[model samples]
Target: MRVAKQFTPEVLLSAPRRGPAVPSPDGSLILYTQSAHSFDDNKTLKEVRLMAVESGASEQLADDDKVHDAQWIPGTRTDIIYLKSGDKGTTQIWIADGADPAKDHYVAAEYDAPISALKVKALADGSVAFVVAGLVGPDGGLFNDKTDEKKSTGRIFDDYHVRVWNELYKAQKYALWYSTLINAHGKWGVAGELQNAIRGTTLEAPYGMYDVADPGDSFDISEKGITFIAEDTAPSSPEYSGISHVYYVPLTSFTAAPTVRPRAIVMGISETKAFYANVRFSPDGSKIAFLHSSYDSPSDVRLYMGHTSSFGAYDVHRMIFGKRPRLPPKAFEFAGDSDSLLITTEDCGRVKLSHLELRHDAEATSLVESGVVTAFYPLQEGNYERLLVTSNNIVDSSLWQIVDVSMTTQARVISSATKHGAKYGLSHGMVSEFWYEGVNDAVVHSFIIKPSNFDETKKYPWILLPHGGPVSSWLDSWSTRWNMALWAQQGYVLVAPNIAGSTGYGVDFTARIYRQWGGAPYQDLVNLMEYLKPLPYLDHSRAIVAGASYGGYMVSWMFGQDMIKKFACAIWHDGIFNLPVFMLQSDATGGGPEFGGAPFLWSNGEEMEKWNPARPELLRNWKHAPPTLIIHSEKDYRCPITEGLAAFNTLQAQGVKSRFLTFSDECHWVLNPENSMIWHQTVFEWVEKHIGGKEARNF
Candidate 1:
């Protein structure tokens, strides 16, 4: 029971912290991207780096101002193909061969029209196929040239007449050109113009199979072509808002005619309640894996695989299906040359690695029981014999290397990394799981992290940090630099709860928080505090509730409810204040009928009225609002700046200690390194002022 070296904030913030450590096909090299910030430039860039797997010698590839979507072309002499931000805000493809950085070449030129290339797959024939978008001019630019010519002529006429005809001709020319670009590259790109392009069938529908309006998810490319999962928002079934369907475009057809239409492969009706998770294709291009669940079934995400060729027919006989035992499947890998896969599942109590195999009848069998397999990776080019596994027992994010293949197997830890009892002393914190009965007696899962220097004899301040996606959960993993680790270093304990609406457990557990929003989920936060009040080491009198987005909404709601008097302060980042204003002011991109509808608000108007923090009357009724910090980005289109501004203003008007911080250029998530550092510094300083003593400042 000897403890190993603890992971520190510096180590966690270092390069190669997270993501797929996917090796090149040859296994001679490994390609991965790291998020780095240039102190001189003040920008955040994802730099692609290559590492020699055997020697562990690594070097940087081309540093395209911003690099993302990295893929290796499969062949004898493979090259890395990636997307680079080009001039005029376009993303062009660039290819690099060998380890020579200067030899990198840009494949496509910057197009006058907006274009995006997605999911590049190198074909056996030495050609790459990808999903691309060609944006046309605004308002069906068919009349653009004519209108420009007329505008020029009118300007000349106005110069001669001075004030007589300039105003009249200017208005007319502007109106004439107002007709947006209806067609681009022979494809209909506009939404409203019907005659410009065929609507339902002829012209590509906006919410068809290939178009993924949200950029958070990734698409897959196969030898057959490129496939993407997108939400089908056609008005025929308005209730099927978040419903996602698969679409495929043949490589040959796409190459022959770049404007070729994408074919719908698999379609499903989501009933406007569920979330369409990630879609991954099998190595053989014969099967597709995906997760699907709704609000009522939050914790349960059913993992299903289907034959690629047979779209609607999800024959379980040809694929494998399993219910993920944890809250979220962090990462998964298919075993090399075997009908099995390695999955990483995190529950509130612990993180587990599971070895799942597809039986002869395609049934999934779990190996290593529940807590044995903690983290796993299947060895390549061999039988399913060895795996890279990491495990934990509440206080450690232990990293281990396991050499095991079957269930009745013995695992030896090749290397060990722990959070305490090392040469350098313990620098990491422990993750503990706790659960309590929530709304409807539903079991709510959560994790608490005590600081590295935690002492059982001393009472420490606490911070309740909730995740953004009411569906997202906090797991047993190392902390990130952006995570509230700075607070922990200042002697504060952090609590992340899965509550009722988190994924990975089961569908029913996840769906409990649906439109109920301000009800059960908020109650769960208070319940967690009540459960933790008696803990000997926790200082319940100096607690603070904070979070971003949905978590921010929870903080705002908690402040209004007077739930916890011990809260000295609260921080709300990009949170929602008024659901109605949020619904009205927000764009049509993320929030639609699928998420929570405007009409549904009318049905539950009382709940909306009672919960919305933006209501002036509600703000006036606040008797004991905590000292609050409102942080938001002006350019944030997701939660919008108005929400944060309203909350800050209301708190200030009520003579409560509150301040507003806005990042002018940042989005919902701060990507700039300077701003991120400043944000962390501010939070750390705030926590230290309220909770940290001189001893806590000694790091």
Candidate 2:
């Protein structure tokens, strides 16, 4: 029997796929982002594509190079709107409503400033409202204002200065400014900067940005109005108190700023109790639903139902009765009815769809059981009940499928957008789930990727991967960064365990590592390896451990421990070596809670050594540490360069064989294609050198 070739970094990374399938208003057509890699330019070329639902056909939208937030102009499949760069990198919204390929209905409108954020709502009256984020340039720009407000000389900072990730530090505030397409006299004019802000916000509560993993436009729209959540915090202060209030304002009465600034419905007395977000208006726009977490993390997010009388006050009701979901609330789409929603969330190790029925008052039910649903894009209900969804398990990458909303049968394939696996002759690596009891009888789940051509007769090196987050989970999905298939291609079995601190488990399970970062979770990894040591197919002597971010912190701590020496080598990227330096240097928005309390020291004023890997308490463990490889970038503000530098120096001073890999341009992630290639190639070479295996062929 012959074995098929498995995936490599280049093969997996260059796969062509339609990004985030978005169905049209009438559900006839679907549009999505398409990206292709350019070897000459060393960049990814992005374009918008439209797909016909009936026939699996696709056509690329021309004249779009760097499209952002491209969505079908609601109500019609003919029109599409997206943001792109103009002169000097200033983004403006462009519209394409075309019936011909050669002659396109293209319009590019500028409001005289860089469009930092934009959201378009297709109104029933044939006009569309645009919520844009600009720095409020000179002469009031658009919206018909004539005020010559003098420009401030320089940015004045009292406390927080010079840095806020994503947002620039400046005097002019970034507010959600409204604009409209005015064709009253058969001419389109960019309007609505002078019109009062639909929902004005300060710098602290970034109106247009996302602190979590979400799309660009933070607000969602329906036929009736819009809904968004913002917290009231000091504008210049660099802190998030996690206090958010949901607001709903109608399109007609949004003439002035703060047209309706209502207080939070049933807000807790303590500001730090909960953080609210993912607000949505039901299909009919009569009901609203939003998610809130007791803590800043996504563990305890719960769905709260409410009713709003046409953008007036909201009577919010918390859902009381359903089996509590294992993960946070996500993928909220009204199920064509007033009572149900089509949503998907993390369950065990996959993101699966669920039908939530909001009962009369307090009770709710999970109508459908969760399954292997990677992603879901809600579509308008046709005669047949269906939706555009991306479904996959550990053995397959997610591809677009039209699943029955009724769940009566298997899903039908809608499109084959990703073809790189076939193009490069890549075979699917086998995957399976493993479970073990860890620290206090808690059941920890893990996913394993066996070698492409697996046989029980041969033993293989093990690659134990610890996920970062400390609050995130390892979901069953395709990844370009850490390719599981690529590792398996190198004849190594990949083991990724969702340890105690990982999300998807309940809130208490996630919070168990609050001040015990180096305690139980570390034991879970070691215990998992111990349980697997008896397996005939695993070569524990040649095993290696690797991680990034909090995973990096774990690796660094493991490197500092002499008692738990189970592996031959260790690797960490952007790890937190010194918690004290981490808290002060990194721009992690929320601070202090992970350490159990605020910054504290003994009477001598020494830094807190509880969770700091760089403390003297853990210094002796690195005396005979395994061959270590440290990877970090200089611009990584989230974890800071100081961490890697300190760890590398400590390893060298302690006489441990180590190598330090540094990148000048990358921030938290190595996103550039060429840089990514170098990252994979070098890291694998280091692993092979230490583990006594020959390097695998690079693509």
Candidate 3:
């Protein structure tokens, strides 16, 4: 058996960690960001660095504390363009040339206006085109003026809308402005502001363009206008509750008049809403690539490529991956030329990359088999490169290597970090695979992890860690802060089972647990315990069930079921105790409606009644609950704190030991550093108390 190296959090997040390794137009150098974890400060920092691919030598370009995205200045061989903070919190354009760090110049530094959103485009001529958002007042200025007035009035607010309305009322009025930078003359052109247009009594502001490029300082090409996909509440019929439509505005004409009208590209009168949009153009700007999906199910995104000349038209020549009955497409990159693209598809637990040629009715050639391709980039004109690849076999950490098309290549340093002093050493961990028969001889796949220093002769307590998404899969990654790792560090074995519904394998596998709830999947857990009870190193009597969100639902369900007496405690974080109540109180107020507003409620009233632990009648009769700890956040609209409180109160009424903790300033997930530390501390202490004892720390 071969052991793979271990990676530190710093290495996993290092800048240019996941995105495209975009080289300069001239290809003299390649720029990428490496994200590194600062253990001292407990924060991540992104450092932009330039590498001469020919020499393999790299140097740090600039270190802006808040810098995120960076790009090179087109037509300039020695200079790079980046955004930096000016006065207040406003970001302005800064130019750095050669290796000189201090000898940098700022374009339009005297304007004192903020650049809310910016992009640099290299054009046919040796100039750069950019956009800036300017507003009246100080650096951190906003658009509306009534916001500060409302805030000064000092009124208590209970909802997010009221708070946002007050802030908008105080914001300073602003508009989108455009300008150009001439590298030949080293000067910025006069700025142009956008004008507003009114449609049906509602005024609209310019949202800006996707790409901007300057040509010889005097002329510029700003293409790919802003398009918004939003849900339309007004419908023609009761059945057609709402529709999702795309609205676009050209950058050049947006500020002049209301001549341009938005054309609807995709029209669907349903309950589905667009969550996010990723738009990309071919190298020659002749075609565009877009990924669209619903917020409720983001994994269902479908990729489409369209021609640039045909506005609001989707090219039928393009292929749709998720439209078929299969796993959703993970990611794709255009390679070889504008005509060819590389598509990566993942289903259930396997990932495959293929070369997709647009010409000749979309032909595809497979590059690899079932495995996770962590990162990839274009290595040559026709061949794409793979940076890191890992297999489904959890025993091995992902191996980082440079693989070219037509052949395979291997490299060292697969894991991000080795021992600090040792030049290169492998990281150690165990990955176990087992199948437990559940509900009619159906096998459920599961993964287990023992402590780093596992002793087969000694017995170890078990922590059952359930994933948040009921339909999501538990992938093998070097996850440092995963709950399983936290417990494994404390001398507890971790068990994560795919059960019947978890994703990765296929749609059928995921759909099985949809309405099952506390059914087949729950039985899988029982079977797992039964399978593990006889193991020499396993302490069947000492077990804990813990999960968040849907997993939380399972944890609470476990306490209610008369399955096994081996578990000592359970931990629920923002879990759903009752399905009917969850649907009613959640931010999604219209019930679990489908695409056509058809309610996809639970299977039957009996299922709903049986699963809804929060029902008034059920709460009154409840007696046997577990020693449970419930944690919830005040701002979690998904699984609201109300649900947590209801469960806690019901458990207490039944004489079951239960505790509830509410975080005031957190959302569904904790974000604040200090608050996060406190939350983790509390969680570990609870685990220690229930799981018997803790192991000695190695460091």
Q: Which candidate number has the best TM-score?
A: 2
lDDT of 3 by residue, 1-699 (tens): 222233222222221232334455444455666655554677666677765645646677766655544666555655666666554555556666634435755554334434444445554554455544445444332333323244355655332212120021223333334445664466443234332322322212222111121111111123444333323433342222222444444444323443565443442325345432444556665555655555344445566555544554443233433234545456665674676676666643446666767664444566655335545554332235432232322323333333444445433222332221122122234556577777657777777877667899898888787676666766654433353443564567888888766766654566566556677678878787778777888786677788888788777676666652457777789888777667545544331212213222443355566556566654554455557788998877768787788778778888977777778887667655456555666665666666665553332
For every model shown, the clashing-pair count is 26, 1, 21
Least lDDT summed over 10 consecutive residues: which range in candidate 3? 210-219
- The top-ranked prediction according to lDDT is 2
Error of 1 at 693 (Å): 5.4
Q: Give the TM-score of candidate 2.
A: 0.87
For 1-699, candidate 2 gives per-residue lDDT tens digits of 222354666755665645767777677777777776766667777777777878867787753575677766654545667777665445666666533334454455754445545666666677776665555433333321123345764555664434444332554544456656655453344554434343343422234243435523345565655566655545333334344566665655333344554334453335444567667777677766777665444356676656667333322323434453345665566676777776666667777676666663443334233325645665663322777876544444546777776777776677654332343344444678789988888889998888657898988888888898888788776667787767777778989999978876667777767666787788887688778878899888888899999999988888778633778888889888886657666665453355544443432123357666777768778776788889998777778888999999998999988999888888777877778888888888888888885555555
Evaluate residue 249 in candidate 3 and report its C-alpha lDDT on the 0 to 100 scale: 40
Each model's C-alpha lDDT?
0.54, 0.65, 0.53
lDDT of 1 by residue, 194-250 (tens): 121211232222222222232323356566644455454333432233455555544
lDDT of 2 at 180: 66
In lDDT terms, how accurate is model 3? 0.53
Please report how far candidate 1 places residue 127 from its true position, in Å: 5.0
